[model samples]
Target: MNMEDLTWGQFKALLLAHPNLHLQFKYAEDALVDASYHITEIKKAPITSVDCGGVINNWTEIIIQLWEPQGKMGGDAMKVEKALSIINLVEKALTLDAEANVKIEFGNSTFYTRQMYPSAIAVHGNDLIVDLRPDVTRCKAINRGGSCVTADKGEECCTPVKPKVQLIDLAQTNCCEPGSGCC
Candidate 1:
């Protein structure tokens, strides 16, 4: 199933009902985090930025941070019910936006720390597989409009224009040279 199709709240509700399911995160084809990882923190990140075209953009995300404890080995993964309990605890302390997008934050000595979005979810035997994809940068202005800068492709928008340079002959000018009286 496409995990992106569901909001954070809907996903949490699904998990809460599936008490026996196990979770495994696949960051890449070869990069997988098994049950040894712990849900260290649940955060609400609100981001606001001005795009290259000077338009302001704002959004929020439910950030889930996973940590693999040192010297930990393959073990029974955290159950879905246990994760729901953690979420409940977080909700008690801080309000979470149910409709906000969900992002998983993880990294290791070999992998740089980064936030990834859930791309897909699948059930493999007894495990719930979550495939995470890296977020990409896009030109917000272009996405919101046909032109790069503005919607109307008017004077404020970016348009291709031929470059021109005017050449001036210093000798033909009235301005004086070092010895000229016009100096």
Candidate 2:
């Protein structure tokens, strides 16, 4: 998740407030998860990475995977109350970080399998829609005012410069003169 993304606490709070509403997930414009989608699993992952500036960064993410079984068709989405129950069940097994970023894992025949952040949660009629946005690639070093390369901002973060080499004219050397014995 990005710096401005919704956190796990925020997501749960929204669900709590709309317990009576049906939960619907929108991955893209006009692209929504099937009404029969299931909350297959919830994963808590801790990520540690070294950025280009050699800075160690750590974060946690709470990912909820949604799956719709094949041949399953038209039905109303699960109620927010049921989704909360699943969350509660997962909490019994592992402690979830409220501050962790939230992601939704889902895919169908048209959408690719990837984790998306909850950009917005809105009430549309009887449905509580979780609008998901794809996770984007970013340079942590650049975000922290450091450059990945010297050319980026005239500040070298990790890349090193290659030393310039000059060529020598071997034809001008005296080694072929036979030690000055005159070949």
Candidate 3:
């Protein structure tokens, strides 16, 4: 499929409406399994101070704050180095195992995050936790690290990853939102 043909809005909208649009993740060892989560939220922090929330580099995995920010479930409260470390894990794994996939679970058995972000994970001071949601099942297509099973059920393979985690890589962080002037 020609990704260039699809706009982010179209792509995301498709995802939101898709019956199989699900998320997946990996761990220390073992094939990538679906991650379980209680809540999810998106916040913006300088790439240098971002511990969770929002996708860092466009190609890396997405992050959700797992700690409460001043008693709020969703607010600015994370560290950048920590965020990069998590991104590094995903990059490292994708490089070594291009076939990796991730799964995410949400609270209340909803495939999507609750309208009210749950503060459970964040209250513990843990980084954003990765997991699968109950409402949606899985994304329909997977060209990169998606689910343990490829998007098309044994059709597409993962994309190649560039070398990462080197010190120079961290210094080269760029804005991720294309054309939005953020990156």
Whole-model lDDT values for every prediction: 0.79, 0.86, 0.30
Candidate 3 — what's its lDDT? 0.30
Count of steric clashes across candidates, in order: 0, 0, 29
Candidate 3: tens digits of C-alpha lDDT, residues 1-183: 332233323323333343232332222133122333222332222222211221122222223333222333432323334334454554555442221222222222212232121111111232332222223332333323444344334522334345564343434555464664443
User: Could you give candidate 1's per-residue lDDT for residues 1-183 as a string of tens digits?
Assistant: 456545788778667666798888888787787569999999998889987676899988899999977766887788877888899999999999888889899987777889998888777788777788888877777877566755444544445555786665668875665754454
lDDT of 1: 0.79
Residue 55 in model 3: lDDT: 18
Error of 3 at 113 (Å): 8.8
Candidate 3 Cα misplacement greater than 4 A, ranges: 1-70, 77-81, 89-96, 108-183
- Order the candidates by lDDT, highest first: 2, 1, 3
lDDT of 3 at 178: 66
TM-score leaderboard ranking: 2, 1, 3
Off by over 4 Å in 2: 1-4, 146-154, 158-183
Candidate 2 lDDT, tens digit per residue, 107-162? 98878899988887889999999889989898887877544653446657666657
List clashing residue pairs in candidate 1: none
- Extract clashing residue pairs from model 2: none
